[model samples]
Target: MPREVMIHPLAPAGEPIPLVLVAHGSRDPRAQASTRALARGVAAARPGLDVRSAFLELAEPTPAQVLSALRAGGAPAPIVVPVLLTRAYHGRVDLPAQVAGFDCAIADTLGTVSEPLLAGLVRRLREACPEYDAVVLAAAGTSVASGRATVAGVAAELGRRLGVPCEVAYASAGGPGGADAVAALRAAGARRVAAAAYFLAPGRLYDTVMSDALQAGAVGAAAPLGAARELVRLVLAAADAAAPQLALTAA
Candidate 1:
């Protein structure tokens, strides 16, 4: 009793489809710079592929602006990849509303617990502290239950991969902040606790969490996963998977 789905070529004769990486925008300059860097990395990985970066809010060149420019340049409907790690508010509502008028295929949000993404987290954590017995996956918390669940899942998997107990902490919204999480881990008999930033770019929330963690006796905190090689791979994979759907939608 299910409908069948058809996949089509991205263009009339298999022309290259533009990929737009949409990030949760921030007012912080570092956030914008980090996103632009990610766009560059994606562009570099696929030599001739068109890769563009746009923000959903609090940043320049919104998704609509990017799509309009692409249309003006005679490019076909693009595959919009939400560079989000979870299907939170931005991914679920804001992004869809932003691109509603555009004839583009909206790809799935880059999930939290992808292998490459976990690998990137490990890489960043290790780079921050060579040895740590425990970690706290600090995230910009969301009130949505599903989003919180995804973040918790990421924490468990990350802990398993690192062979340490990882706890989930929030930087904003409603939850235990980074300091409290670090304190809990310490009281739970974790000798050396580190905070792994569950963010795609450097922003106010990330800064606050990292600072709080460090102040609360965390050995060190990993930086945001900005322009990391693993992230680049994930972005490309998302675009490729959505290309056919985008073509179908455009048809």
Candidate 2:
């Protein structure tokens, strides 16, 4: 039996552009699943648009492979949107190297601090536990100075939003780890400390933060920003911003 193609009512009249969302791959299957789920959400929101997910490594369909396939399929003007949370090494160096010869435009990495992201954090924190005296923003740390700065800025912004002091902690590579941060809060007489997952997916880093922080006296740890509607909107917004870049590339 032939299936009828159902067009989305809100779909644009003309051919929609393809969006290649490239995520930092993980060894944990949940990371890949969450990445795909986020892409699915974006595709659902903008029905006619071609939204695809690819990884950096430790996963199938690397970004290069996806881009090559898109080029071979005669995609005239596709764009690559990094599913990364910050403009760190991956976004600054690796992604460009991957799409070097490809004609597709690359959108900006999702910034550290945004209204939608803040709301997502609040939602996750509330779901994890009740109001706490302190919060720690747990991130996958990087040696890059700018990357650390980005996380710090986000922690500050989150603190403002929650009207509570929020400290930045690292899961790998850099400074005060989740356990350390939580312990500091506990030592300072904080009866209840919550750690917010300043990450995109569930993986080794996130798991470490949750487990270690709780062991170090944190009351709870929020879930990763997986498949959040706000994240989907951010991805789509990134793609739209790059639409004009296609014209510039053609020129």
Best candidate according to lDDT = 1
Taken over the whole model, the C-alpha lDDT of each candidate is 0.87, 0.83
List TM-score per model, in order: 0.94, 0.92
Which residue pairs in candidate 1 collide?
none
Give the per-residue lDDT of model 1 (tens digit) for 108-209. 888657888898999998899888989999998899889999999999999999888899989888768988999999999999999998999998999888
Give the residue spans of candidate 1 off by over 4 A.
Answer: 1-10
| Candidate 2 C-alpha error for residue 35, in Å | 0.6
Q: Please, what are the lDDT tens digits per residue for candidate 2 over residues 158-229?
A: 989888778888888856888899888777777889999889999998888678788888888999989988
Error in Å for residue 207 of model 1? 0.7
